[model samples]
Target: MERRIISAGFVQDALAALTRRGLDPAPALAAAGIASGNERVSNLQYGRMWLAITAMIEDEFFGLAARPMRPGSFNLLCQAVLHARTLEHALRRALSFLRVVLDDPAGELLQKDGLAEIVLTDRDRPRLAFAYRAYWLILMGVMCWLVGRRIPLMRVDFACAAPENRSDYHQFFGAPVHFDQPRSRLVFAAHYLSLTPIRSEKALQGFLRAAPANILIRYRHDQGLSARLRARLRATPPEDWPTLDRLAADLRLSPATLRRRLRAEGQSLSAIRDEIRQAQARIMLAEGRLKVAEIAARLGYAEPSAFHRAFLKWTGTSPAAYRTDKQG
Candidate 1:
């Protein structure tokens, strides 16, 4: 997968810790070969800057919390949870270690009603979004690497008001984000907690070597979850798409369980099928080769007229007009 580029504002937030300590971030920025005013930076560049800042302050957390998270503290956390059999056990171990090391913003892992929540308890001082993000990235990043898949977030709530670059939350988490929420928490399907961790000790070493950079950007693979689900839909023609129950049974899950999991990830079976058809229609139209009627039949439409209506609904233009516009 292509690396995700982060906005300059994210860097500014990370540098806030230096500013808090009355320390200049110039040297750290220089170490990372980044400018103070650059509009964006690659994941690697941001990770470099993060390391430089941590070394300078002797705190992995940038001194945002009541106590400084000493260097190698995160490494120990990774080691502590390395042998955990499932995501649930790993998270339990991880949060326990964090509470002992960091004084403020206690973290809790709660699961109920088929959903799991990682809630951060607020203390004396108001928490910055950076602190919230750091805690999340640590847990989330580790969890993804542990399960060998990106656990899609349902929603992320922050206690602090929206920051200047709050949109980055959507780009990073790929979910609806709300600011100034009652408490800061990350939510996802509880079933994911039962997934067995698949990474090895050597893999953990390599992962920590890259640290938050690799964690910041997910390296895509045939890992698990919806990627496999989407791939299954994409492989079969629209007319041959299996029923929900069949698909669920094929994946060894109950139909209701499958539906609930997809819903938690903010997706639906019908919606995914529509997206696939839409994408195929656009590509075929752009090619300017296939007849409109032929394309409609291949997409499982009973008549060209029905396809026309659906096309208009999807793109606000007739298929012929869409083709003509693309051709021109």
Candidate 2:
């Protein structure tokens, strides 16, 4: 989660907006601890940069339009939706609240063909892909938080032209994304509408403190063995990573049975372990808070050279080279 795993396209888009507004993006980037020349920024860095930019412009919407969404608009919206009895009520109320505050991009919930769609419509200006991405992310994120799971997206449609990185859309929505559509919308199972909100006012406080960070990073706690395993791995320190046998025991399965289950799920324990380590390494390196040797040790590597070899194999670049390239 600490890694600079986000696509550089987002940063570029934000910078472009700053430039268009005749504002210097350097200060925001610096405040986020992001090197202006870097290709990508960590999620935390992006959140910081976003907050800084919004503060400077006094618009939480990032100057995507003429009218500014005041800085505390999101907080107010969350408060309004918090007392809803069901997910449907929460979304409908939240969207209604937003419509009153913002002049464009009003939202409506439509039900048809066993699917519930949250459609967002805006004044027909050339849309920034990043802006649309952010819009969809917030809506989907808040809904998921309410239902206590990652809602399986049935369809995601955008009004703008397809982005150059089309493949990324699939990963973002966990469903194929269609562009050049009539309006921006997210479709999912209608059943989710009746699901009660699992979050309470106490929980909302923590969510508000983190702001967009909790939403921007999509964490699926609902399905997928890979996601569950990834969550467990993330919760445990790299140095304390359990052995396959121990992991199986923890999951209440024999080692052989666990192996079979993993293979059936189209994954392997070793592969998942490697992924966790690589992700952690990338984040730590991006943060630049630890030395290479220190990171290697923290990741349970016996020697720095072993860590270097593993990193090179995983990333096709030496650790130092990867860090330098990403850090600019």
Candidate 3:
């Protein structure tokens, strides 16, 4: 099994921090022999770029004479987090902004059943070796400090067996963090979503717009089939829309096999087709040049009425109403 690496977003975040501390990041990048003109700097797919930046920070910025800067680095991140309006908003911002401080490909924060669950997807990796757990701990601690009250954890679930540092985990989270579960997650009450952010949206936007190109490419991977299907829909004409069997064949699987695989992934051929149709319909409606009948024929509908019905199902309104709303 291959080891997935940190994302370029993570590297850019670290560089941003170093810059905040009045340090020139160009020297660090130069030390890593990463050329200024390298497109990878702008591309998000270069996960190793983050690893290189981490090495530089540990070696040059902190140095052997001092302890690792993990604690201090985390402190700065937590300071940013406390500025958010609500804990829910803060978590979303943290997910977007704090990629540099840690990298865990198998982790995600989700809301379900009126609670927030920080889900960890990886089970085979060493628990202590995971960077995101440390980040989460610091975040929880800082959030408590900012709110002037402790947030009780509803439950904790871990994928691995008990670690040697079990006492540390218990003390830090102040919850019964369990182990040997199918998946790891931190469950918390949902009401924390209403807190106002301490930081300005303009400041956050600046960071987002200035995000390194490499980071964008890395994050794009998570957009999943929606992106790929969209690209295909855009590039192909309606007349050339591939049949399910043809698409399955192109993907190197039998039609039945493809349906089974999609089922496992919690998707379906009909859903994908409907999604493509709805997207194309919106684009056509927005363009305003195509007649409704022409659009229906172009979309492979047998009749304009059939197309109207599908459009109504897709948007809860008639196609004419949708176009009128867009014009309005």
Candidate 4:
């Protein structure tokens, strides 16, 4: 699967926040491998830039309406919730911790009518756009990490009026979103609250290192059958990939049924195969550990020319050119 990319508007927001505090964002942007003020950035670049900016300013919340969430506050927050018996307990504990740290805007988790609702409320009406985005993302990310599944959202309600980039929020939240509502809240199935936290301290050590990058992928297996199929393809080696008929058999469905299912999901077996192959090719090229011929063989391509053609088709450049661009 292709890695997610972030809109440059988010970086612009971060820059504005830094400028307000008399800080320079150029160095951080450079460190994050972004050379231009373009409209899109790879998710990895966004994560790097976000961490660098927050670290330089010593404020994890990026000086958004809330008090400066001091450096290391996120680690502390993660530690505080790591051992909860269930996601419900962990979520409440996390909200309580944030409330104590940032006072005015309080986080609440409520379960009623077979739905779990997570809300961020502020009687003082603090600057909410940035803060709300971060808080909701944090809550959803942490909850999903705890349960080892992407909890499908039913609806996301925002108290503030919709912004011009409202569609972006809908994409990120993966659900119906209502603006100009009485409160900012996320709604999902209540049963997720009962799922125990599957992460151990050891597991969390690696996860924390990845941080926001892990959370930003817009789609996950629970979102649809296509995502699940992509996950399966990703897990298997390219040389060992199953044929369409074999894959369908393994999935316990007929080839015709599988095709129909994938079509309904706006996907096809060939596209999924190509995505996985392209992703692998890029990774191998970026690593620079293998020659083009070797990489082609590993990807099950019978000839180097075929691999080169596919690479050009997928990336609009030759494999060698792509590698050189990435390495430089």
Candidate 5:
């Protein structure tokens, strides 16, 4: 599967946060392998820029909040919420944590009529849309990873003016983004709050090691070459996953063009295939109805031992142990 490349406007907006502070973004952008400002960027490059920016500014929130969010702020927040029994517990803790750290934009979790909303109340000036976007990314990113699935957003409302890349923001959030609204808020189903978090401690540790880069990947839209390939692969069984040539033909592109596009998106067919298999295996393990060997066979592993090692490589734990942990 190909990772979607973001618009040039996003690159500019992200870096603008630094430039507005009178800090040069050149060093960070260069460190992330970005050049001309108008060029589109891969998620990897953009994520790298985020790390460099945070490290340089010593603020994960781009110094938008009155109190600078120190380097380890997000890490501590994740660790604090890791043990929560359900999504609602985790979110409330997250909101509370933000309240203690940031002076403006108090966060509240409210539910009524089977819907949940995360509202950010700005005490004085409304925050930049990009800043609000980052906050949502952090919360929704964690929410999706914990639930082991994407929690669909109903709509995102922003009090700030829409930027030139409004459509890009819409795609990034995978939901409609309304600008110049009454307040900044995120809406979703209240029932999602009751679902238990599916990530294990070990898995979260591995996730934190990658940090914002991997976290950002969890929440982008199904766009571009990777999106098309992902749709095709998910529609077929593991055993029926097509070869590159076959997939290229199906996509109506020459094999060479397919290869080039995948490269640009920082993706490979084999890696995408592996990702699909890993996802299917994880879902099966979570359901707890299938035997390990049966699940292995369904995922195209002829031998259960091969499946065990593969699962270990993907999740940092053996299949049986992972299943046991999830059950407990």
Candidate 6:
């Protein structure tokens, strides 16, 4: 399989954060084989690249402090958060506007009662393979810095069992860390919402709009495996219809292992394959050139009748009717 790249906007934010801390991020980036220059990075591509860079910087340079907050991005995000009308509104704005600052997969910020929470879901399975725990720490640290307060955290939650670093949680979050929970979360006092924003709306919007595409893509891609799998199917179609075994092999796992892993991730091979087929069939039908037989063959169906049945199941209409609907 081809290696995924990281978002340029995310890279820029990380670089900016590193620079603010008086550390040269170029070496870490170069160690990950990324360019230190300001070239645009596509959000649709570069997921692995960004993850690799993030891992490198966190392990080598930032360690526990490796979050967007260390750079000015978190402060900028806080400015937007401070400008909102209420704690709820502030968190909502932060969720909507802060995507450019961090390449986090779990991106929910919610407030209730007297507590505020930031929820992050790790999509990757085998629990600890991904560096989400480190990223979570970075997010909390940055948020604390942005509010300019050592805001006390109520608790921390994770889907996985406790790692060896359980002791460090208190130092970083200033709260207790809970493991074996349904999801990862950072709980805090609700009072942080009333603080005034230090940055102007115009400035915030400018930063969000001009954020590097690379980072945006990372956010989108990291959200789930279904999306990532669909993107892969589109980019590199096999010569024949790829079977579950084949696809799993390509992703570097046994068929049984893949099924188990996908199950853990709340997905199934059949669902993903059908999704890809339907998506491709729609695109082909829209082009209005290929005969039903050719489209069927391209999609790895051995017979046009089988393809037609599948199409009807997918769209609730036959292939011809679907095409007519699109053309009309």
Question: lDDT of each model, Cα atoms only?
Answer: 0.79, 0.74, 0.54, 0.75, 0.79, 0.54
Model 1: how far residue 78 lies from native, Å: 0.6
| Model 6 stretches with alpha carbons more than 4 Å out | 1-90, 97-104, 124-130, 198-328
Better of 2 and 6 by TM-score: 2
**Residue 138, model 6, lDDT:** 35
Please count the clashing residue pairs in each candidate, in the order shown. Answer: 0, 1, 18, 0, 1, 12
Which digits, one per residue and each the tens of the lDDT, describe model 3 over residues 159-189?
Answer: 7676553354454343567777777787765
Candidate 1 stretches greater than 4 Å from native: 1-4, 219-328
Better of 3 and 4 by TM-score: 4
In candidate 6, position 154 carries an lDDT of: 56
Kindly list the per-residue Cα lDDT of model 5 for residues 22-81, writing each as its tens digit: 998889989988885678877788888988888888888887877777888888888878
Stretches of candidate 5 above 4 Å error?
A: 1-4, 223-328
| Regions of model 2 farther than 4 Å from truth | 219-328
The model with the greater lDDT, 3 or 5, is 5
TM-score of each: 0.68, 0.67, 0.39, 0.67, 0.67, 0.35
Tens-digit lDDT track for model 4 on 1-328?
Answer: 4343666666676666678888887887898888755557776787788788888888777777457788788778889899999988999999998888767578898875345788878876545565677777666677677666566666888888776764566666656788888888888656557778878999889878988667655233234566777778778877788888997888899999998987654457776677567767877999999999999999889999999998776556788988888899
Q: Write the per-residue lDDT of candidate 2 for residues 1-328, one digit (tens) a residue.
A: 5766566777777667678889898998888888873476666788888888888888777777546788998888788888889988998988887678766777899985335788888867647666767666666667666656555565688888887854656566655578888888877656558778878999989888887766766432223565677679879888888888988888888999987866544457776677668767877888888999999999989999999998876656778877787688
Name the candidate, 2 or 3, with the larger TM-score value. 2
Q: Which pairs clash in model 2?
A: 3-283
Of 5 and 6, the candidate ranking higher by lDDT = 5
TM-score of 6: 0.35
Worst 10 residues of 1 by lDDT: 218-227
